[model samples]
Target: MSESLKNKTVRGVGWSFVDNIASSGVTFLVGLVLARLLTPAEYGIMAMIAIFIAVSNSIVDSGFSNALIRKVRVERVDYNTVFYFNLAVSVLLYVLLFLASPSISVFFKEPELVKVTRVIGSVLVINALAIIPRTVFVRDVNFKTQTKVSLISSVSSGAVGIVMALSGMGVWSLVGQQLSRQSLNSLFLWVYCKWKPSLEFSIESFRELFGFGSKLLLSGLLSTVYQNVYYIIIGRFYSSSLLGQYTRAEQFNMIFSSNLTSVVQRVSYPVLSSIQEDPKRLREAYRKVIKTTMLITFACMLGLAAVAKPLIVILIGEKWLPSVYFLQIICFSGMLYPLHAINLNILQVKGRSDLFLKLEVIKRIIAIAPILIGVFYGIEYMLWGSVFTAFISYFLNSHYSARLIDYPTMDQMKDILPTFFISSIVAFFMWCVSLFDISAYILLPMQLSLGILLAFIIYEKLRLPEYLEVRQLVCSLLHRKNKLDNKQIWTKN
Candidate 1:
């Protein structure tokens, strides 16, 4: 990699982490408050409509932002075309959702969904207005601006959600949160981003971009549908309260798993795309990314699982305790998400969205078995079944990576298994400590310290490269921060 690209990647990674951590942290704190203020069934109500919102959002993008990012020579008309296309699609979809809200309510046997759907469905259009700005920032690898946007949005919306929840708004507080967050996020992106679309729409640009993006659209649609299919099944076949428990588990798992994966995926995609032509550089970079991703993702996901019980009890109260088992199993499944995401990103970097779509089709087909398990057996079996599917999907996702970049499954596993092994040991130790008859306040801290201490010892002894890299990154960041602080103090004086 060139020195410039290396520096950009490093800076992008730092800001991306800050963006996700700060934004997700605020969102999480708000969720904790709302979870306490609300009932399980209330969360379930929001989860029930989450599928529609997710699918609509996916369709709104239709993978165009990715296409725009992947395109090396993006034109002004291209941005304008995609902006109009996305906004138009979002509007159409919202209308469809508005019309279909009644049926959605009927299917779930929850009459409240009709109004919630219309209100939250507006976010699709609101989000569309900011897609171009967000995409522009991402393509430029400008996550610093994004961090500012996300912090402001999350803080503002979280305050709104908390106030509403405290006002005893029930499930509507969740709806209010979603609306406020998206609206603020879109508004801030416009404020920070200077890109304004012109009145030009180019069919040539549309066709060119869509040629690459359409396959991703299909793949994204499949992925989105299946991802939320669990909510659909649980909402339809099971009770809303149970679905709420399931949603809580998934949310907790996502806080670490999805956010970490996203931070890596967002920055890695643009960086990897830039070097896609150089086979040797690409493969080496790919290896480092997979290892580093697993190193962090495995420890966090498994550690969260280890402290799942006490964490849930202390943070959201004891009523959410049922989510503990579901969270543990889901964390195992979530741990593999980075591997899955990175592999897919490789295909996109290679301009193999056709292959990407095929993989999604196959994986979603296989994913159906888990949905059946949830429908017939239970949610636990469903979550376990998901773990099995995640492993299978990893192999499937890696197939093209091995073919394209020579980083085969065995090689990848050999690289990541050490981290996984160490993480599992720490988790097991924490879980054992958690089983003791102790207060959650003490037990949570004890398990956390023990997990960290064990991981530090293992990594210090092994002298793993990924660990060393992370250590260096943390120290470098802190040193730079301290220097800036000192400089600011001197300037003031």
Candidate 2:
């Protein structure tokens, strides 16, 4: 990789991590407050309609953002075309969802979902307005600006949600949070990104981008639906309170799996795409990414699983204790997610959206039996089923990456195995620590500190290159910042 691209990737990853930390921290704290103030049934109500909103959001972009990012040189008309197309689709989708709200309520046997669905569905339209600018930022790898946008939006909206929840807004507090965040995020993106849409709408541009984007659209739609299938099944078959517990478990698990993986996936895609022509460099970069991602995420998920009970009780209180085992079971599956994401990102970087769609279909098909079987048995069965399916999906996601770049599943597994082993050892030690006679308030921080210290010691002793790379990058960033501060002070003097 070129030095400029490498530098950009490093900077992008740093800013993305900062963005994830800020946004997720705010969301986590706010969720803790809301969980105490509101009942599980209230959370379950929002979970019931979450699929509709997610599917609508997918339809709005339809993978055009990926298409734009993949293009060698994006034209003004391309942006204008996608902007208008997304806006039109989002509006039509909102209208359709608005009309279908009653049917949704009837299916879930919850009449309150009708209004909640309509209100939250509006986020699709609001989010569509910012697609072009967000795409531009991603393509340019300008995550510093993206960080500011996310932090402001999350903090402001989280505060609003907290206030409303405390004031007894109940389920509407969650709705208010969603709407406010999307609205403010869009507003801020428009303000920070000077890109504006023109009156130019080219059918040719739309068709050209759509050719590549359509496969991604289908793939994304399938993936979104499948991911939300659990919520659908749980809410429909079981009590809303049960669904709420499951949602809470997933939420806590995602704080590690999704947020951190997003940082790697976002930065790596554009950076890898820039080096797509060189298979050797691409493979090397891909290997480094997967290794580093697994090193961190594996350790996190395992450690979280070990401390799940104490963490939940301390953070969200004993009311959410029922989610403890669910969270622990789900973390086992969550550990594989970063692997799945990085492997799939290779397909997009190689402009192989067709394979992306194919893999999605096959994986979902393979996943269905386990999902159905788990649902039939119970929620615990379903959670264990997910753990089984996650490993299978990782293998499936790795197939195309092997063909395209010669980085086979076994080879990838071999790369991550050492880190996985170390993480397991550390998690075992932490679990032993939890068995001690101690209060959760003291145990939680003690477990965290021990995990971090053990992870660093093992990585250092093992001479893990990814750990050293991350350490060096962080030191370099801090060094550069200190130099700049000194330069500014000298200039003032």
Candidate 3:
């Protein structure tokens, strides 16, 4: 990579890390408190509408944000056109959701969701208003501004949610929390992002962008629906309390899997897009990204699985113990999430949304087995099926990377398996520790600390390439910060 591109990648990774870490940390903490205060059925009611909201939000953007990001150059008219288009689509979807809310309640058998869906579905419009600005920031690889916006919104909305829960608002507390967070996020994005839409909308611009984006639209819809289909199945087939347990388990797994995937995907997509023309550079950059992403992902996911029992019981109380089994099973599947994401990102950055859509269609077709497993057998069997599908999807996604970048699936697995093996050993050791006859309060922290320390020691001893690279990256960042601090002091003197 060129020095300029490398610098942008480094800075983008730094701020994206800050954004996910701070924002997710606050959100996780607030959720723990809410879990303590609210019942599992309440969370299940909230979970029932997640798919609708996600699908609607996906339609609102209609893949235009990605199209804009991938384009070599964007015009003001393009932004205006996408903004107006998204706004109109969001309004239309909101109305449809509002009218369909009762049916959604009937499907879930949760009459409470009739009101909840209408209230929470409004985030589609609220989030649509911010899509263009957020996309612009992402295209520029400007995550520093995003870090500020996310942090403020996360902290502010968390405060409001906790207060509402304290006031005994029940499920409305979750409703209020979702509305406040998205509203604050949009407000802050507009405040920080100075771009405003013009009255002019260009059909030409829309056509140009949408031509590249339409396949992505279908691809995104397929992926979104299947991703949230578990929620749908659980809410429809299982009790609300059981679905609530699954939601909590899924959240724990997401803290590591989804957050890390988002950070890497957001930073890598724009960076890779900028260098898409240089196949050698793109391959090199992508290889590094996948390795580093998997290094963290494997360690976090397996480690979380190892500690799932004590962590859930301690954080949310014994009432949520059922979530422990769910979380452990889900973590096995979650470990592969970043690998799946990075492989697909190659197709996106290469402007092969046709292939991307094809992949999604194939994956969703295979996903039916898991859905059936849940419906027929049980939720645990469904999760085990998810683990099965995840590995299959990884192979399918990596097959394209071989054709596109000459990085074969086996080679990619070879690069990542060392870290996975090391992480598995560490996790096994931690699980052994958990077998001790001790209080969970003692066991949780001990397992966490020892697991981390052992992993570090083994990685250092093995001199693993990804581990050393991450260490060097951290050192370079610290060295850069110290120089800036010294420069400031020298100027003051």
Candidate 4:
């Protein structure tokens, strides 16, 4: 409610937007370069280890970092406790990852993983060192500094990746890029924020934070496990090349969804935490967030799904053509990832993590495991697995959250139905266009503009008042597109 906090919130949102643009842009560029340079098979090997590494890393933080953020009564010493706790976990993870690397290689029948996993696995320590500084920065909403640090680190990592890929380092190029980014981020954070821990641990402080943290940790672990289980299952049964293709397709499709949702998640958590007490006001904010998220998130995923073939061909080259269906399938499913994430965070903020835990267990079974079975059946089945699991998980999470927030499943569905109908029509129409070989330089924009314009027209025609408010929101944004559009203009006179 104070002026300082309001400024901090605004700064956090701005920082998130900038960080998403800079980091996602850099990642997109470097990823394109790597995709061009490395074979899908090589990327697949990395994907396999990524599954292991991601799950392990998620467990390292679980949800405690968020718990630290949301906890209202945190003491100054609580910061160090969370830091030490994360540090201990990171060290233990490194040892475990190193020891387990041989078995991982043996299990996957890829002996190279023994070395590769251990090397990439060192990021656990780097990431752990980052937790406290990031936590403190986020706890206070110092997004401007965070964004600057992130931009530098992202650009640096991208440069590392490109050079490594050009030098024929293969998979290690990807590994090196990741390691450099994590190390640089830690260094930046340490320099940017003057918060160092004493050699101290407080059980009491830990206990205070743990109340909120246990829920976040459980939610985080389950969430991570669910997200990556497909890779694990696929890598176990399918060849690394196939996994690599699928991973690329999936990752490429995720650019908009992840960038947008991650921005909201990082920004919303602290914002929502600060406004947790008044259920009416909290619910209002939640409604707007959910609606806005639905509008962009579904449209993004749907657009990507409609153009999976061309997108894969254009961006990743003909070598990865096999991933077209995989991309299309996963793109549709990923739309719901953001909503599920935000809704789950509501439970996290309300201190009703018991609900979150139960939801996670069901979600893994309903959403994750079935997809693994889809791989068991056939690769074509992977697409269906994605669609089916998304429906089930979305409905389930929406239902669960509706109880607490009192916003029904239909309300959420109502917001996106326009997107659903518009996307379907565009997809059907685009299918007719795709029947021939139209050059993407012409087709991509034609389809994109058509889809967007059609959606806007339809939304205005039917939901004009609602769309007007959204337009106002956009115009009111501090960084408007018109400014950028005019930034590089020339005066012919």
Considering TM-score, where higher is better, how would the candidates rank from best to worst? Answer: 1, 3, 2, 4
As for candidate 1, its clashing pairs are none
**lDDT string, candidate 4, 239-327, tens digits:** 89998888887777668777878878888888888888877877877876777667777677877877777777787799999888888
Residue pairs in steric clash, candidate 3?
A: none
Model 4 per-residue lDDT at 295: 73
The Cα error of candidate 2 at residue 313, in Å, is: 0.5
Query: Which ten contiguous residues of candidate 4 have the minimum total lDDT?
Result: 484-493
TM-score, cand. 1 vs. native: 0.99
* lDDT on C-alpha atoms for all candidate structures: 0.92, 0.90, 0.92, 0.79
Per residue, candidate 1 scores C-alpha lDDT tens digits across 264-361 of 88999999999999999999988988888899999999999999999999999999999999999999899998889999999999999999999999
How well does candidate 3 score on lDDT at residue 457? 92
Native-structure RMSD, model 4: 3.4
User: lDDT ranking from best to worst?
Assistant: 1, 3, 2, 4
TM-score of every prediction relative to native: 0.99, 0.97, 0.98, 0.92
| Model 1 misplacement above 4 A | none
Per-residue lDDT tens digits for candidate 3, residues 1-493, read 7888877888888889889977887889899999999999999999889999999988898999999999999999999999999999999999999999999988988888888888888899999999999999999899999999889999999999999999999999989888998999999999999799889999999998998889989999999999899999999998999999999999999899999999998999999998899999999999999888899999999999999999998999999999999999999999999998899999989989989999999999999998998999999999999999999999999998679998999899899999999999999999999999999999999999999899989988999888987887778678878998999999999
Q: Which candidate has the highest TM-score of all? A: 1
For model 2, how does the per-residue alpha-carbon lDDT over 1-493 read when each residue is reduced to its tens digit? 6788778888898888888877776788789889999998999999999898888889899999999998889999999999999999999999999999999999999989998998899899999999999999999999999899889999999999999998999999999998998899899999999799889999999999999899999999999998898999999999889899999999999899999888887898888888899999999988888888888898899999999999999888898899999999999999998888898899998889999999999888887986787668888988888788899888888877899999888898888898899999999988889999999999989888898899888888878887887687789788877998999999999
Model 2 TM-score is 0.97
Looking at candidate 2, the ten consecutive residues that score lowest on lDDT are: 366-375
Better of 1 and 4 by lDDT: 1
- CA error at residue 287 for candidate 1, angstroms: 0.7
